[model samples]
Target: MLTKRIIPCLDIKDGRTVKGVNFVDLRDAGDPVALASAYAEQGADELVFLDISATQEQRKTFASLVKEIARHINIPFTVGGGISSVEDVAPLLEAGADKVSINSSAVRNPQLINELSKAFGAQCIVLAIDARKIDNAWIVHTHGGKNSTDKKLFTWAKEGQDRGAGEILFTSMDHDGTKNGFAIDPLSKLHALLTIPVIASGGAGSMGHFADVFALAKADAALAASVFHFGEIQIPELKTFLKNHNIPVRL
Candidate 1:
């Protein structure tokens, strides 16, 4: 069986790690580079650095931060936020990011996915979808979950795969920072629909949530921010918990 990955997400705003409920009411968690190094040292499978305000602020962010974090950690990391074109990806990768995640930009121009995949190989292009349940449907939200689109979650995910996205990082806006659990139903549905890896994000409150996401939803990876950022769960301990539950994970 393929070992599931545990990713620590650092939501950056003003160069600091921040976490919030439903994508609002942000509060500082810690310094981004320091947090990245800590998680890497703690046996985190990978790190995701998202400049949370990049899209809304309308600026390129994280290149310098990515480079700094890269120097401190000897593990793969992904940088994202306000990345729109193929030009935007090269600098981050050159800055030492193993991958680049695109959300709002990809939603605005679906061709960006194809262009990026063709330019840098599909393995490095991650399509990040932030969605929320509304009116009995999961609608894709953009601009860091401040705006909603007509696109449905499942359909958009399928389209993203066909468009050459390497992996799907699905964040449930409804469950974000709630400390309840992951959105298992949609995660399971995503796994059923796609061949590529599906990363379940949001609402990771405890170690049990990690096991549930992998054993129940069968997510290829579980990505969480507040839990890891606030020291509520340690990556090494979470892996041990998963292993006890008979879930395969790198220890």
Candidate 2:
């Protein structure tokens, strides 16, 4: 059986790791390199570093910070934010990112997905969709969950897969930073619709929440930030807990 993955997200703004509720009221967490190294030591399956303001500022990702984090961690790392074209992906991969996640850029020009898949292969491209429940439907949000796109979550995910994206990182804006629980209802709906691996993001408060996401949400992986960054939860211990609960994990 394929073991489920636990991922830690680092939202960097102005070169510092930060966290916020529903993508607002940001607070500094720590240095990106230090946090990446710590998560690596904790046996996190993967790490996602999103330069939250890259697109809004009309700038590329932080290659310097990427290099800094790359120097210390050996695990698979994904870098995202403001990545529009193949050119933007180069610096990130050069800085040692195992995968490049595209959100706003891909939503604006979906062909960017085909181009990335052609240039870097599907496995190297990750399509990240930040969604929020709107009137009983999940609407796709872009620009660090600040703007909404016309496409729905399911349609986008299916199209992303068709465009050759290897995986989808689906985040729930409502549950984000709430530390209540993952939005399993939408996650399960998306998981059932997509064949590509789904990485669930937002609202991971406890080990039981992770287990709930994996079991009920049918997510291939769960991604969280505040809990792990603030030391509220430990990755290895969480893995053992998942294992004890009969969840398939790399313990």
Clashing pairs in 1: none
TM-score of each: 0.91, 0.90
Instruction: For candidate 1, write residues 1-251 as lDDT tens digits.
Output: 67999998877776666664222222423667666666777899998887766453323445667778888889898888888998889988888899999998988999999999999999999999999999999999998799999899999999999999999999999998798999999999999999999999999998988888998999999898777665778678888888999999888
lDDT of 2 by residue, 106-164 (tens): 99999999999999999989999999989988999988788988999999999999999
Best by TM-score: 1
Alpha-carbon local distance difference test for all models: 0.85, 0.87
Which stretches of candidate 1 lie above 4 Å from their native place? 19-29, 53-61
Output the TM-score of candidate 1. Answer: 0.91
Cα RMSDs, all models:
3.9, 3.9
Error of 2 at 251 (Å): 2.2
